[model samples]
Target: MSPAHAGRPGQAIQIGRDYYEGPLHICDSVTSLLAHYLDLLDRGAYEVGEGDDYIGFVADPYESGFDPELLSGGIPHDVPSGLQAVLIQVNAPRSPLDLTPLAAAHLRRLDLKRRPVTDLTPIRDLPIESLAVSLHDGDLAPLEGHRHLSSLDLATNTTIDLTPLRTAPNLHGLDLSQATVQDLTVLADFPHLRYLALTASQWASLLDENKVPPALAAARLSKRDASRTEALSWAARLGLTVGASFVISGTLTSDSETGRTQ
Candidate 1:
């Protein structure tokens, strides 16, 4: 009933039927999320808990094995007061989620999985260390004040400019695998950025231009069909000098210009 927290990246802990890692890998299934929360509550997991800082809530009528009775009144709006991270995903038509209520000095991470939000203004002042979100309007203007953000994983349905994040001094890791960045050239301005994940085309452009951020220590190219040869070549050109992995191995000519993964 008591699950220890995995404090570092790439580590995982088991909670009920789910595996808990960092904020992003919180319970994914709706049924499992509810069961884990209830079980944790009964075990007093919320009392100065370790990994209980991360919680996930989901309410999707179409989700497999979903039962309405488990959340009769709809998704709970309130979260544990001392919670440090939260993941909320609701598959239904509704207004943007209001984050003002969730803002707290103790909160550090948040994952609003594909849920539209009013804006980033509510949490700008909060000491957020990491964020994973989907921007409906692709506006990053509200991110200027987040000086403590160390990681950001963005999902966009459309192309977006990365210029707004240039001012964040503490940003060390960025994930744009699910986004279409208008200008990856802006990444050069981030002196602290050490890890980056981008589409194949984006990485290729960086290689071609010889503009890979000098501070980068690791990178991930998001292309499903890209051959191991192509990826290794790309990394070599970009001065990555690291081993690369592929989901599915296939031959790819240097002329391949595919950008989007999906």
Candidate 2:
């Protein structure tokens, strides 16, 4: 059976049969969507909607024969121009995935959560507003001139040098949890930053009265061995919300101010 439904706001056009039962079939929803788009491309039907739509698929590149390069070549010839986003889940490593053919001007958002992408030079010149990718041992110099970037997630990367982010003037939110970034001073460059998440290595810098930026309103950190009293005291002094998992508005209660998790 094929999945049938109209695309909605903030929802992606999921094109896979993982949600279905029984063995994996070739003529599943993913294949159907791919075939439909391929047919449109072949017929030169270049008019589609501009309703913030996206297509997500999980398949092997070689076996599925769904080359991502087609997005920059044949797919864009028929599909709507300026497609919102595309999330490709590949089974193999980064060696097999090539994004050189994708045009960044038409793509605004991209999500490559766990993909082993070490080099970001390909999509660096594109106008991406939001991005989420794995940066383990990855170089961030390519992202320096991306002024339109507002949200970024580098939580899984370690020993990352965030000095390049100083050029990104519009960055508002950043995630660096589970990473080993020691310099909290680099964050001062982000004037519009409101939310930040850090690992145990970097969160301790917030304990210093002057280290936490005044523009920050919330922060997430691991409080396992931290002095909860001092951390909360500084957070209250800075008028910021701090937590282990998720940060929310409001100051810590007075009752739990004695080195205890509130």
Candidate 3:
């Protein structure tokens, strides 16, 4: 298909089984795009088009007996030309995996959640805007120079130093939930940061009015303790006047400022 006939070549496109006739269009979210691709893979109808841009594949070891090698080979060679985002989710073998096929200089986003990948030296120079990875004692020095990065998810990484993030001036959203970071002072470097997530216990440490970034707008606290009164109290002090939501036994219940479960 001609570049003009196909929607904007830069628009995000999710690879799926559906026989789409024209250029791909943007999807509502990356999660939905991944679901469409997984459905296509199940139906054995997924095909990579020449004009395709963003694409993702998820392999569930328990359900589909996912083979990392097979998934790697399935990626088309043309994907490197204009591909923007490449999300790969794999299970088992907690070791770094080389994703040479998906490595493109123009790539803008990458999500390797729950994957065995540890080393990120390969794509360190790419102008990526968003990145999510699960690293276990892996070197994070590669991320030090990623100034274009805006959204980062290091939730699965336990041991990490926030010092490297000082260079990422464009960072806006960050996820450090379940991480082993002890210092909240490092966040003062991110002048543009607005959204943050961390363990409930870390809320107290970040409550220091002088330490919290002025632009911080919202926060998601996971692993919440039985009583969130202290957390909410801290939030109130930080000028986060918004209400809170509580997840109990997988059921989310909106809570008012009075601590009443709505």
lDDT of each: 0.66, 0.58, 0.63
Q: Which lDDT value does model 2 have at 45?
A: 53
RMSD of each: 12.3, 13.8, 10.9
Worst 10 residues of 1 by lDDT: 64-73
lDDT of 2 by residue, 165-194 (tens): 878877887887655664767787677788
Residue 199 local lDDT, model 1 = 84
Q: Rank the candidates by lDDT, best first.
A: 1, 3, 2
Among these predicted structures, which one has the highest lDDT? 1
lDDT of 1: 0.66
Show where candidate 3 strays beyond 4 Å.
Answer: 1-79, 99-101, 156-158, 224-231, 241-262
Q: Pick the candidate with the highest TM-score.
A: 1
State in Å the error of residue 141, model 2.
1.2
Residue 20 CA error for candidate 2 (Å)? 22
Question: Can you give the TM-score per candidate against the true fold?
Answer: 0.63, 0.54, 0.61
Query: By TM-score, highest first, what's the ranking?
Result: 1, 3, 2
Q: What is the lDDT of candidate 2?
A: 0.58
lDDT of 1 by residue, 38-96 (tens): 77667655544357686433433322222233222123456444445555655455456
Residue pairs with backbone atoms closer than 3 Å in model 1 (clashes): none
